[model samples]
Target: MDLHLKGKNAVILGGTRGIGRAIAETLAGEGANVAVCARNAGQVAETVEALQSRGVKSTGASVDITDADALKSWIRKAGVELGGIDILVSNAGAMAQGNTPEAWTQNFQLDVLGAVNAFNAAEPFLDKAAKSHGDAAFVIIASVSAAQADRADSYGPVKASLIHFAKGLARENAAKRLRVNVVSPGMVYFEGGIWHMIETNQPEFFKQANSRNPTGRCATPQEIANAAVFLASPASSYTTGVNLIVDGAVSNRVNF
Candidate 1:
């Protein structure tokens, strides 16, 4: 309940909107300092201001996560500015679909490399925080699509790679008290997100998508964020190298 997160600092990628923004706000509300980064300078600024309004020290930067050097630099700077990164959330994704080479490139660069660079840059800060507090975490936002795919696409494979990466990190960093985990969301919908656009332009497909969910609906950004923030919190100290699926049972694959 308490989460014991007060005074901790967190760095979030793509925290300007959607599920990323919700995670930032949730951490801020839990009394954790937050730093977010995204390509939109205006949105980054707005999110920073909004997080600070929640009475937590907050900062943000405009960053293109596809650029490994730039993403790593921002993450390092954010770790310092936040006073040490106790939690790192990789919530950014290209969301590129299809089997085209370009789609694969985009997903690999943004979704895959983005998490790799962020973790590499934040490892030192994360190790330091864990050494001092006995708990530090990296939460990767993946998708249930990673577990099952109906067709060839870049999105699912890239997300699946992240799970593998996080598991390796978790095992290697366990001695450092740095826990790594994944929160895989299914069909999360938010205004201006992909689902919203689909609802507007491809009404029948959107309706069919909703109907596919056993709950007869999709998840909210906040719903996914709740799982992410929980994993990032000290309360889940023993929950490393695990993928928590928050899909309202939309996904049929059993974890067994």
Candidate 2:
């Protein structure tokens, strides 16, 4: 499937590991230059090197997404280095699950505001790309938790806010040929990921979660990445303002 993404440039948040890393690799494999950022300097360097191995121009920075000033600066610098930003993938999240004020604040700052700031900083670059290439995209990595209420947690609500925000951005940017969409993954499992920790430390709970999926397993990072990269590609040019769920049927609620 030629995504028609060759020569396109992408900026991905938290792209050093797990789902973010998968997305970055998939985009680079599809021939897009990628710029990534995460707090782990070693991981960031490794990911950038791996992406570059795929024969695409790749760059990375170690920065906290919660730091708006630093994040915006990285985004702008990435745009300058990559020539321009045709795609922006906000894949970082705090994963703060409690109802405490601290949890709420953490989720809001890293998950919600991170996307907000990244998009705001990348807007001019995206606009320029759209004007030149006739298409640009912003794909937010939300979660299926946004639509499910398993407990009283800040994670779900904060993710829900991202969907709402992306919808508005999609509507407002449609005229500019900039698409905005969300990929809501459910129980994606990967080594060193949250689900992996659950599988290791909480065996029974991990089994229960796996059983909840009709597929008898959680999604792999690659599966979720496939959806995200596709949405960010020109092949999905008509798809915008939509939350694409990759939950292996674990979610029962109909989106409509």
Candidate 3:
């Protein structure tokens, strides 16, 4: 199905790797100009090059999402470089896991503040696209853990906040014709960086998660990218303020 996304411009926070990178690739493949930002300057440059090779005008920047001012400036810069911003994918967060209180605090700072900062910075650009341009949307990448709270530092609450924030923003901006939505992903594995910890340190727990999932395994970054594309594309023009869950039924299964 044609997503009707050609020529549109997007800013994907933390799009240097993992799911964010996947989303960037998917969007660029759909013919959208994409700009991604992450702290790793090298990875950011590599991703931009890879996207451009796909024939989409793309750029990359090294910015920390947790810093509000820096995030806002980057968003503005992306809009300028991409020509305009039609989609904002807030996907630059990490699992805050540590056995200490400081670890938990850092988790909230990154998870919650990161999402909030991205949204706040992108709001102006999103509104501009809807009013000045034609159709535009905001797709936020959250996690199924938001619904399950079984993750670190009650990380569930942090993601849950993003889900709710999308809802509220959808409502607030609907009159302006700007759409906001959330995509919740279940257990996903890719490069094996984060997964190494689970598979190596908590093999039993990892086994249970795979068995619980209906597919008997985890989803891929590409799978989650498909959902992000849907939300950000014209295909979902009328859909907004909705939490689209793509968890392979892991969140729905009965846990005993």
lDDT of each: 0.94, 0.95, 0.84
* CA lDDT, candidate 1, residue 120: 92
lDDT of 2 by residue, 19-133 (tens): 9999999999889999999999999999999999999999999999999999999999999999999999999999887999999999999999999999999999999999999
The residue pairs that clash in candidate 2, if any, are none
How do the residues 1-256 of candidate 3 rate in per-residue lDDT, one tens digit apiece? 8998899999998898878999999999889999999999999999999999999999988998778899888888889898888998888776766546776666677767777787777777888888876568988888887777553555677778889888998998888878899998888887755765688889999899799888998888999999988989878888999988888897874534
Candidate 2 Cα misplacement greater than 4 A, ranges: none
Q: Which scores greater on TM-score, model 2 or model 3?
A: 2
Q: Between prediction 1 and prediction 2, which has the larger lDDT?
A: 2
TM-score of 1: 0.99
**Alpha carbon lDDT at 207, candidate 3:** 92
Question: For candidate 1, lDDT tens digit of each residue in 19-109?
Answer: 9999999999999999999999999999999999999999999999988899888888888788999999999999998999999999999
Runs of candidate 3 with Cα error greater than 4 angstroms are: 98-100, 150-152, 253-256
State every prediction's TM-score relative to the real structure.
0.99, 0.99, 0.92
